[model samples]
Target chain A: MRSGAAVLVEALRQEKVDLLFAYPGGSVIPIFDALYDAPDIKLILPRHEQGGGHMADGYARACGRVGVVIATSGPGATNLVTALATANFDSVPLVAITGQVKTKLIGNDAFQEADITGITRPVTKHNFLVRNVDELGHCLTAAFHIARTGRPGPVLVDIPVDVSMAKTDVPLPTEVHLAGYRPHVEGNLRQIRIAAEAINQAQRPVIYAGGGIIISGASDLLRQLAEKSNCPVTTTLMGLGCFPGRSPLSLGMLGMHGTFYANYAIMESDLVVALGARFDDRITGDVTKFAPGARIIHVDIDPASISKNIKVDIPVVGDARLVLEKLVELVHFVERRDWLARIEGWKKKHPLTYSSGGLRPQYVIEQLDEAAPDDAIICTEVGQNQMWTAQYYKFKIPRTFVSSGGLGTMGYGLPAAIGAQLACPGRRVIDVAGDGSIQMNIQELATAVQNKLPVVVCILNNGHLGMVRQWQQLFYKSRYSGTILEGNPDFVKLAEAYGALGRRVTEAKDVRGALDEALASGRTYVLDFVVEPEENVFPMVPAGEAIDRMIGGMT
Target chain B: MTESKQVISAVVENRPGVLAHISGLFASRGYNIDSLAVGETENPLYSRITVVARGDEAILEQIRKQLAKVIDVIRVTELSGQNFVERDLMLIKVNAPAAKRGEILELAEVFEGKIVDIGVKHIMIEISGPEQKIEAFVELVRPYGIHELVRTGRVAMLRGVSGRPARAAESGEEKKSKN
Candidate 1:
């Protein structure tokens, strides 16, 4: 008879979990002991539980697999809240295992005991509390299955100390029999035909892609559909790399910090084909006025996201790639040269531009794009740096741009970059971060260096929280408040302290060279680009305004 | 925002935190839950949850689909437009003075409610029926001075063999007729 820990390990092995990001504690010693004997599963330790959780999220996003994280109960389990919410919001598949106090000690206010399953219920897609050793194997199996299936999300399984240590002869079930949960995968043929007819009849058509395209591995189908229909494409911040950024028909990203042409195309289009995108408030500014003239055709795997924001004329719920494969088959080529010319005119009239001299954040992102390897993964911390990277980085391939899009969590960059590097070994991974956001999880530098993962972190140090400062400047009468970072650490010295290569580039001309040198160092590097302090991300549709009312900069 | 009350009933797995998962879904989304009731179904392995929420058509639709999306939720059905029976159980303790005791008892009889307990200064009445009937009963006894009140929110079931069609046994004829 095997111990419960062995059965758990065997289940994870059956699920093909090769790597686990973990932080050990008193309650989880049994599982750690099992890991000691297991040769195939590798465990990478992080300094903080939060960092490890974000790393798992990054790994899942980069590899399109179920990322796993293990932590002790109470404080350790609570630390994973942010990452769990982040993965749930973005639909990334992650399985989080937290060790609770013994079953008998639970609810008695025992040390290191917390209701982890209850606390994480809302944040996680599904959560389980292991009360019995017999349920341990199945709980884990179900957790992994639920996390990676359908509209993927984070699942948490809280194992009490006794449950982990208890011996059991129960074997792992070959199949999970969740009677209530069966994900609908196939696209309804009637809806597909309706969408095809809409695409064929529309004169000015635009395809709006979201992160779901990348999640479903539908970039190829998206490109084919865009090319076949001769339609311009506008992607949400999460959908950045689903279509080639440099393509003539590509409008880059559309939303609060979207391109002028992209926002305009969405406004003017007669037919809007929304693919795998939830109509979130950020993207659909002033929902009543969003795409007012367009007959929207929304395709998503989750039925709830279809009419949650802007109502659609046609709703198709299915996997992105599957729906697109059938859609492309039914679609016929159509020409709209006049519509293309109008988009070209808009692009020429209001191109993304930044005045020279002080090292603009946009310019730094462009330089990083130039110096990075072809397969480099770009992760970003929130705020101006994230928007700049989304706006300026020319992502030609899918799964290369990873960021905390839906949750907009700060300090996600460094840990995510580490996870991405581990997911795609030998690949160059960079975390583009803002000055304020980088410090949120800067301690992960040690985690990166210790793990020998040569990931780069590019901090756009502007001595201020750029996005909030911009909002204060535009709407708050320039009252900066607590947005400014008056005293900041010397990032170069900080990187050195962490035993990672450090470089600072102040001049615009040296930005590219600094990035190149850092990448060539073959060590975990931190390149601090001291950018223009007061620069603002433009083509922004002010909150509560319609997308067509975008102002400033290119607009 | 044109808000209207929509009653939604869902059958979920009788597992720990399943109620929290459902209630949390509404709370996190900034959706208000006007009333909620949960109890075990005929099958001990499942529980039926009924939620009354006020929102526009879009918000109501979102709630239904989102509730259905939960892993443990087996089926979700909106009971607003359907021929469904809804009920709420309430126990009210009122100060029925010696002179007003007969009057309060008469009102309870009119409402088809029963006097469950008679204290020295107060009497407890038990009532279970549609919300409107309960509300009317409470209003009639309000003058007797209510000392305490407890309600079980709202629970609903479709008339006859009518509910959200089970995924496993979805027949063509079931789709043709509401029943």
Candidate 2:
């Protein structure tokens, strides 16, 4: 006979989870007791549940495996809400296990009792509340299956105290069977053929890639199709590394903060091959005017995402890698020399640039790129710093650029860097963070120091929520209401207090040296670069304007 | 184009929070559900849900795709424009004065409805029919002042020997519209 907690551990073993990020609390002692004896699964305890969740999210994004996290009931589960929502928005596959009150005390406001399944329902792709020991085996298996399959997202399995303590003899299921859950993996051949025909016939075409390319491991197929068709590619924020930044066919990222040439190419193209990317509002500013002349062929695994935002001429639904492989087979080669020249002209005329100032964010990012290894993983918190990393750093590898894309959660970088560092033991992991956003979960510094992860936290200390301040500067007549960080703590001192190396750089010339020092440090390091607060992300398509209607940049 | 009321039905696994997940998807998107019904299907492990929603064709199409994305949902079908049988059950109570009682009884009988209960000041009638017929009956009895009303949303079955999978008929609309 095996206990319910033992069944859960066996299920985790079957799923091949080598590590777990967790925070122990009242209701999860039984599960923790089971984990204590299982030396195969190393449990990394974070300072808080939120940190644990983001760590798991980062681990999943870096390794392409379903990351696991364990938290207790009540407040412990509630703390995971932001990270869960962030993972959901970014389509990261995660299995979050939360402790619950005993089945008898579930709804009676028992100690540490919270409706984790109900609380996490909206954020999670799917959730389960295990009420009995018999249901534990299938429930855990189903959670893992649902998490890692078809447009992946976080899933939660809540185990009650009594259920975990109950004993059962039923072995773990070999295969999960959910009567309602079946995901379509193969691309429909007919739709794929039609898409290929459209690609073959088009002269001025642009390939728009999104995060799904990375999730489905379709970067190689994407590069192959782009090279075959001679089509320039523009990726969304989540799809940075799908195409090499230095490739001639690459136009960098496309969105509000996209490069001028990339945005113009999308608007001017006759055919847009949108692969694995949702035409989000941020990407398609002024939806009515977005790609006005293009016949969009949108390929996504989720049918709902196909035409939800923009109307498409051809809709191919399947896994990104599988669909791209099919397209590579059916698509004919074409050389659009004229289109390439036009894009090159636009790129040369309106290049991404920043006026010289004291420690520009862009310059800092460029130096960080230079100081770090080619295979280093760069995680970022949301804001101006994140955009700068996306703009300046040249990512040539998949799963190297991890950030909160859909939810844009602040304070995601540090913990995520910890996860990435743990996942890749010898590689240098860095967190490009905004001063305003880093403080949101800065307490995770303790977790890093305690675990001896050599992650470098590069803080762009602008003393303001730089993105919002920029928006206020441009559209709100510089009113700057509640955007300024008036009494920010000294980040270097904060880092030192956490028992880590800390340094500050205010001059542009010193940026590289600071980064080098931090990278060379064998322990966790925090480098605060005080940047020009007013520097805005350029080639920006203002809200309610077409992507081509960019307002700022060199003429 | 004017909005049309569409009937959507889905087969889902009988699991906890599945209903909430389905309903929450609509609510979060600001799509109002005009009426809804849920009950166990022929299979003990599966349940069927029907939602009557009014929106333009584009919104309705989005709703179908989004509902189908739910993991617990086995299938989602829009039973509109196809040969199908649909029924709605409504229990409506109306104030009936001495002179208005006869007219109300006559109106209910014309719609093939029955007076299930009668109180001193009101009458309760149960009606079962298509949405249009129910609407017509409700309109005729409006003069009597409806005191209370409840409806079971549309439940539908396709015509005999013409069963088509949800995904098959769905592609027809996409091909017809070229979108």
Candidate 3:
């Protein structure tokens, strides 16, 4: 006979979980004790449950594995709400194991008792509440299976403390039999043929890719389909690295805050082949008028995502890689010189640019991209820093750029970088963060230092909530009410206090040097680049407006 | 795209949180649920949920797809376009004075409703029929004054030989055999 906690650990071993991000509490001490004897699974503790959750998200995105996070009940589980929503929105595979109050005390207002399963229902792909020790092993295995399969999202398994402590001799189930859950992986032949015919008959075709490309490991197939069809490609923010950013046929990103030429191309295209992309509001500003002239062919694994936002003429439901593989096989080469010339002209006329006088965030990101290794992974906090990195950095490979795209969670960077660093031990990981966003999870610095993970955090310290400030400047008549961040701590000293290296650069000339030193320091480092406060992300399509209509920096 | 009512039937694993999952999906997506009914199907491990919602074609398509995406939902079918039979059961307590007792009984007989209980001052009638029939009956009895009324929403099934088979049963049997 073995304790339920030991059985749980054995199940983790069965799942081949090498790294587990967790935080201990009163309800989880039994499991923590079991973890003490299990040497195969390395448990990394975070200061807060939220940080641990985001770390798991980043680890999943980086390694294409089911990221696991464990926390106690009540507050510990609630703290993971934001991270779970973030992962759900991005469709990152994550399994969250939370310790619940004892089964007897449940629903009786026991201490540290919360209905975690019910609370996380909408945010998670699936969830379970284990009522007994026999259900514990099955729930865990099923959680991982559901998290990693079929459009992949976070799954939560809430195990009561008594169940975790109860001894059970039942062997762990080797198979999952979820009768209601089965993902459709193969594309219909008729749909593929119809899509191929549409592509062949089109003159101006643009390929729009999203995070699904990375999730499906279809970047290569996507590139093949694009090249075979001679189609120009544009990606959403989450799809930054799915296509080589430096390729001639690449339109870096398309949508709000997208490249000027990319929006123009999308607006003017005769046909748009969307692969694994949901037409989110950010991508389809003024949905009624978005890509008005384009005949859209949307291919996604989720049937609901096909026509959720914008209507599609042809809908192909299947795995991204499988569909793209068939599409690559069926599509013939086509050359549209006129379409290519028009796009090139627009690209030359409206290249992404900013005023180069003061210390600019764009310039710092460019410098970092130049100094970083070819395979270095770059993560970003939300706001101006994320948009700038998406614009300036050239991502040549998939799984190299990690950011919170759908939920737009701030403070996701530092902890995500820690997870990425651990996921890819040899690759240099960097988190391009904003001054306002970094403070939300700055306490994660201790976790990174304690783990001795050499991850660099490049903070663009502009002393304001830069994205909101930009919106207020343009739309709200420059009434920057609460956007300004005041009395911020000296980040360099804070880093030193955590026993990590830190540097502050206030000049444009020193940006490159600071990045080089931080990258070479072989320690957890923070490079704070004091950037221009008023600088705004341009080529902006104001919310609820047409994608082609812009406010500033068109040229 | 004009808005029209559509009936959706979903077979799902019978569990504690399944109802919340289905209802929450509707609430979150801004889909209006006119009425909903759920009960155990032929298989004890599964439940069938019938939902009446108002939406256009696009909205209906989205509702069907989203429902199917729920992990516990085994299958979702839109019973609007097909020939289906829908029924709602209601229990209504109407004030029946000595003078109106005979009239109330006569009205219940016309509607094929059964008089479940007779109180000192009221008559409780159990009525099960299509929504329109039930509504008409309620309106006819409005003159007598209703004390209390409760409806079981709507439950629907396809008509004729085109009914939904015991697919849930087959799956359960498959699992049993596998074990």
Best by DockQ: 3
Candidate 1 residue-wise lDDT at B173: 16
The positional error of residue B51 in candidate 1, measured at the CA in angstroms, is 2.3
Q: What is the per-residue lDDT of model 3 for residues B1-179, given as tens digits with 9 covering 90 to 100?
A: 89999999988889898999899899988999899999998888889999999989899888888888888888787898899999999999999999999999999999999999998899999999999999999999999999999999999998886444666345652211000
How accurate locally, in lDDT, is each candidate?
Answer: 0.88, 0.89, 0.91
For A249-344, candidate 3 gives per-residue lDDT tens digits of 999999999999899899999999999899999999999999889999998988879888999999888899988888899999998999999999
lDDT of 1 by residue, B1-179 (tens): 79899889887888877887888888888888889999987667778899999888888888888888887887778899899989999999999889999998888888778899997888999999999999998888888899999999999988887444544342211111000
Model 2 chain A lowest lDDT segment of ten: A177-186
Task: Note the residue pairs that clash in candidate 2.
Answer: none
| Model 2, residue A127: C-alpha shift (Å) | 0.7
> Model 1 over residues A223-297: C-alpha lDDT tens digits?
999998888999998898899988999998998989888888988889999998998888888998888789999
Return the clash pairs for model 3, or none: none
Which 10 successive residues of model 3 chain B have the least lDDT summed? B170-179
Per-model chain B TM-scores are 0.89, 0.83, 0.91
Report how far off residue B96 is in candidate 1 (Å). 3.2
DockQ per model, Cα: 0.37, 0.33, 0.41
Candidate 1 chain B: worst-modelled 10 consecutive residues by lDDT: B170-179
Candidate 2's displacement at residue A411, Å, is: 0.6
Taking all chains together, the TM-score of candidate 1 against the true structure is 0.95
